[model samples]
Target: MKKIGIYLSFAALLLTVGCSDWTQMEPVDQQPVRPSEQNPELWAQYTAALRAYKAGSHTLVVASFENGSTNPRVRRTACAAFPTRWTPYR
Candidate 1:
């Protein structure tokens, strides 16, 4: 009887530790879908930025914007639009 009680206690302990509420603890999917992954124009802009940086012409980096706008607002918008590739310089 004592042996059976010990075995049952161990089994209960194992059961309590092994079971988890993974469904409640799972991470939420809050990420927005990447535009560059889907859009060709955005991908091209990213490539051009990389090329401009490599060519040692940081000014030309923003000039590659297909929208033909030198406006700082437009540039900022373009920078925010593709964060995965472009990082703001100081």
Candidate 2:
């Protein structure tokens, strides 16, 4: 009885702990924009910035992140630190 009680408790704990609520965004008709094709001006600026970074003119860190994860402060700081890559970063 004690072993059965322990097993039942463990199963209940596992079931509850494993449950999670999922959120779904409203559906969109259009496909998502590709990074390179998003903006011509920003693409040009990013390329120029990449070249400069390669030439040792300045350090550059290219980060691929989701829109939901974008932070306002990080965007502002990245733009302020390196103007050329600003548009692409956003």
Each model's TM-score?
A: 0.29, 0.29
- What C-alpha lDDT do the candidate models reach, one value each? 0.74, 0.72
Top lDDT prediction, candidate number: 1
lDDT by residue (26-81, candidate 1, tens digit) is 77789786867689898999999889888894444345546445554654566456
The backbone clash count of each candidate, in order, is 0, 0
- Output the worst ten-in-a-row residue range by lDDT, candidate 1: 57-66
* Cα lDDT tens digits for candidate 2, 1-90: 999999999999988777643344667799889778889889999999889878886656799634444455566445345555437634
Q: In candidate 2, list every pair of residues with a backbone clash.
A: none
* Residue pairs with backbone overlap in model 1: none
Candidate 1 has an lDDT of 0.74
